[model samples]
Target: MIEKIGNAIKDKNKSAVLLLLACFIFVFILPAIEFTSNMLSIFLFSLIIFLASYPISRKVMFIGFVVILIELATRATDFIYVQYLAQLTTNLFIIFLVGSVIRHMMNQKNISIYTLVKALNGYLLLGIMFMSLVAFCDLYMPGSFNSSGNSDMELVYYTLITLTTAGYGDITPQLPLAQSLAMLIAVTGQFYVAVVVAILVGKYASKN
Candidate 1:
């Protein structure tokens, strides 16, 4: 079954379309299964992105990336409050993806120190923008992610502020899960900037 499905996706036949639709339904229709199914959706999404990038080149990956995000948001939306938030974040993500993808694609040059630094900066910017979207959805849009028994808004607020290193007092995460995620995002954000900047600076020095 897995092989067959993989082949279908590879072929881009009717089954692939059906599977994509099924993925959409599973991702959005079963909010009860959001965590479980989203795991699957996310896995497939990663492949879709890699395929999208490899086949069309990274230059075209942004469109697929943005489409996937919007599709997920559309499917997940149900409650009015959550739907509103989903709509907002989805739009922002699409815009960010377009700008990020275009800049990277347009600037592509033979891989070297200069290209490497720019690519890292590009990826880091993309990652943070994506994280921001997730934070927004997690906070404002209920059911976009499972709360596991906590205030969703608090999660959103904490995610955004923490990722930005804002450390706002109003939305400190008390739960172990939230705290862990907060720590992870903080590390990710800082490391991304540090590593990318260092690489670019190194490249600059070598060029001079």
Candidate 2:
């Protein structure tokens, strides 16, 4: 059973599907439920890491597992130091995952549904990764963002809007670090879209 599961995860398209589904739930569904402990959020994050990391390497998968363990400890203890560790590990893992997805897409010779899904997954992961950074900034410096509360879901929402360059003005970044992060997120979002479209078009043209 373990081998079968590993083999299934090794399939890039299958893995991308699972990762995208997990991201969709974390981004869309979990916020509505709004659990106080954010237990569900972390669980989905761990699942995404597990799915996303397998396509890269077993080493990355193991590291992501360790990060998930740290996140679980953060939720259980709610210690500031553990939270810091969780934030760091989660941020690094997501960054690595995003890079791996982009690298994989770049190496693909044909543009298919898997390529499109990987692109989408990478985009969503970019948003979530920035969300982690935003949360880290808030944790390190309280009142970083002008939100009613510092919930993970609120950060996710703010990050998504900032990433899309929406500038809703409802949740503004107050601190220097937070404001810089918002700008970086917005720029990175635009850059990712531009690069991915170029890659896809190039691949399609080559195929034709």
Best-fitting candidate, scored by lDDT: 2
- Model 1 Cα lDDT, one tens digit per residue, 16-76: 2443354344333433333543476466544535332432345556655665566566766
Q: Model 1, residue 5: what's the lDDT?
A: 63
Q: What lDDT score is found at residue 131 in candidate 1? A: 49
Candidate lDDT values, in order = 0.50, 0.82
Pairs of residues at least 3 apart in sequence or in different chains that clash in candidate 1: none
Over 4 Å off in model 2, which ranges? 1-10, 74-79, 205-208
Model 1 TM-score (2 dp)? 0.39
Q: What C-alpha lDDT does candidate 2 achieve relative to the native structure?
A: 0.82
In candidate 2, what are the lDDT values of residues 131-193, reduced to their tens digit? 778877887899999887845678888999988888889999998888888889999999888
Provide TM-scores for the models.
0.39, 0.87
